[model samples]
Target: METNEPNDGHAGNPFTQVPIEITISVGRARPLVRELLRLKRDAVLPLDRRVDDPVELYVGDKLIARGELTELEGDATGQLAVRLTEVADLRDGL
Candidate 1:
């Protein structure tokens, strides 16, 4: 049976216009309780990954993509940005 539902895919979906928040995970750090408590101002906490490691992008707890950290040039100089290296297929939803 013919229906009135739009056939234009997400372009016709109202929710597609909604905004979402993405979380970027650079790395993780594990420290003993005593070490955590010992943290003071200016204390350096080492992470498990190096600066060149690919960072993960997540929507809530689900990872959506991986990318490299980069600094914007020109007018937005010094602003941090992510250059996506890998992206998950989200056709089946998050």
Candidate 2:
């Protein structure tokens, strides 16, 4: 009943210090060269997803999870964020 006990055995685990990169793929686009060249400042190349669609998360090239896009307000940094909706299995991640 006391699972809250601390375990120092993993304190030196190298993986705990290692950092991994996660990428989010919203959607893809395929535009002609002429169409691309015609674009100017403030141009919009619409992606292939809706506003409520979840984006795919990837570690390197392999997809690891899916999340919904979210905006952070009143932060002054104008940064965007994601909220995970579905995560891959631990075995698949490994």
Clashing pairs in 1: none
Question: What value of lDDT does candidate 2 attain over all alpha carbons?
Answer: 0.84
Each model's C-alpha lDDT? 0.93, 0.84
Itemize residue pairs with steric clashes in candidate 2: none
Candidate 2 C-alpha lDDT tens digits along 1-94: 4447486566657886689898889998788999999999999998899888999999888878899988877854567798999988856455
Instruction: Pick out the ten consecutive residues of candidate 2 with the lowest summed lDDT.
Output: 1-10
State residue 19's C-alpha deviation in candidate 1, in Å.
Answer: 1.0
Runs of candidate 1 with Cα error greater than 4 angstroms are 1-8
TM-scores for the candidates = 0.86, 0.74
lDDT of 1 by residue, 1-94 (tens): 5557666565557897799999999999999999999999999999999999999999999999999999999999999999999999888764
Q: Which candidate is the best by lDDT?
A: 1
